[model samples]
Target: MSDAHTADEGRAPRRVLVVMAHPDDVDYGAAGTVARWTAAGHDVRYCVVTDGDAGAEDPETDRAALAATRRGEQRDAAAVVGVKDVTFLGYPDGRVETGLALRRDVARVIRRCRPDLVLTHSPDRDLVHVKASHPDHRAVGSAVLDAVYPDARNPCAFPELLHQDGLAAWTVPEVWVRGGPVTNHHVDVTDTFHLKMTAIRAHVSQGGQSAEFEETMRARLAALARDAGLPDGRLCEAYLRIDTR
Candidate 1:
């Protein structure tokens, strides 16, 4: 962890690519910060590794239909934050693995997006919040990290992308990881907290619309804001900021 502060300032509008394991992962983790970025004119896109086919609490649910529904919900959620473009890789919901195939797929997206920054879950597990350290989340995070380093930047790693698809190698300059063990950056999302809540609520299949859920989320943000040294009543979203440049 570096320092608890906001993101890079005074930079021009940047292209940001967010990679997550499931549909509402971004909303639960860093939607507030993302809202702030888009409000500042950044171009943000999402690459959801899975369509959340296995998210339903009921095991008898139709997974294929659930996947389609979740994809639509994610798009609606993204629209609330001013983002439009979203890609779903259609990987199995609960069985994601940190393997070469996953890395290659993420690398392909990185090369295509050519984003200045990549945001994703932390590869590390959080003991305090075990749910944040889901296997799929860690797997996707690890794959994205691998893709950001050598795979996405090295054209030799995926020859097909160069010869067949013509997606030139792209180097992501920075990465912001959510649900990490430590947070070095904080975004004051008091202004856009409503937007974040709206985005979360858009995932109707996830059932987060209750007043108690909102209260719990508010308490969590308030605690994080205090950790960030923000004044009282301020809401914040925190991340582990890493410089890949």
Candidate 2:
């Protein structure tokens, strides 16, 4: 869809939720697009499935410390994208599951956020490379999709959330999955690319030559934009739209 259509459509989402498996996943995949959404006056919330405890070195580093550090970094990243609320499910780094429990947690967030749209990883995240795809990504995506469907929208499911937490039933109208083969939507993020890069640079504990990774990340995003037929010199983020009609 074109930028003009996104701006003109009356149905454009006012509240958006982005669910991802790791702290930096959204920054790498969709932070620029999120900046666009927030700039358009939409409320954006970020939900990270894992604490990223396994992402750091220094064997003596406690899991709680790592989690705390990551959470702060995530919040900083969200701020860069103009998102004010950020949540973490506290699931383990590599062991997210697609079961009733995870679904319930995700459903609770969906209901509480009352987002008109949700964005998440592709269920088939291993399509590019088996070893490259993190298992947590697929698991979180599947659980989020289930939550957005009959679980979150249905008042009957996860009754505890409604009774105990005061979260109401909510049905998000659209879901956009990133890292899919059939990318049908592109968001012009030329104005937000630098913000995205800044967010990514905040994850300094995950040791690497910062200069190298940043350059590589910029090149990759540029290539992705080009592959999606975005105009030259315009950075973009791509996604596959799924209507929850």
Candidate 3:
């Protein structure tokens, strides 16, 4: 669908929840935005669907060890931007699917957090970031979107979560899609850009330490800021703002 936008359509959400596919996913795309939100006293939580076990390049890498390593890295990275609570769903990396089970898991978090704003990858595959729009990313985006809509708002859809888990239904007013192929909204992250880079660099197992990775990210964010019509040297994160409700 083409992006439809209303500039500053509503006030910034007071409570934000970020749900993504893997350990480094949020930091890579929306950490700066998260920093901006937290600095403004908004409550933000991150939910990672995968354990990142399959992120290693070498076949000899231990999958179990890699998953554990990535989890710790995510926590440290989140801390850099004042996000203290992160939930890891522990699904196998590269094996996520957009299905009922995944939807239920994401819905549970939504019901519990009851966030007004949700941030996630584009539900559609992003041609712009071919590598980032992995099978896992697509799956999580689809599931999270499902969770945000009727599922989370309708307790009848997931009775187990309501009856067994005692989590009530929640209505999230809006969802912002990060790294979409088309962008209609942007967050000027000039002040928090350094914090974002620091958070991204915490993912040591995922090339966060590579100079090339850092350089590429800087260039990308700077370009996004320019395209967003921010000051020439400003840094920003772009999104397609989706009003889910």
Q: Pick by TM-score: which candidate is best? A: 1
Tell me the TM-score of each prediction against the true structure.
Answer: 0.97, 0.90, 0.93
Model 1 lDDT tens row, 1-245? 23754544446999999999999999988888888888888999999999999999899999999999999999999999989999999999999999999999999999999999999999999999999999999999999999999999997998998999899999999999988788888888888889989999999999999999999999999898898888999989888889997
* By lDDT: ranked, best first: 1, 3, 2
Candidate 3: tens digits of C-alpha lDDT, residues 91-205: 9888899999999999999999999889998867777678767888878888989998889999699899989999999999998887557778888777787898899989988
> Candidates' lDDT values, in order?
0.92, 0.81, 0.85
Q: Which 10-residue window of candidate 2 scores lowest in summed lDDT?
A: 1-10
Model 2 residue 171 lDDT?
Answer: 90
Angstrom error at residue 136, model 1: 0.4
Clashing pairs in 1: none
Which residue pairs show collisions in model 2? none
Scored against the true structure, residue 245 in model 1 reaches a CA lDDT of 79
Better of 1 and 3 by lDDT: 1
Q: What's the lDDT for candidate 3? A: 0.85
lDDT of 1: 0.92
Q: Write the per-residue lDDT of candidate 2 for residues 12-38, one digit (tens) a residue.
A: 558889999999899888888887788
* 2 or 3, greater by lDDT: 3
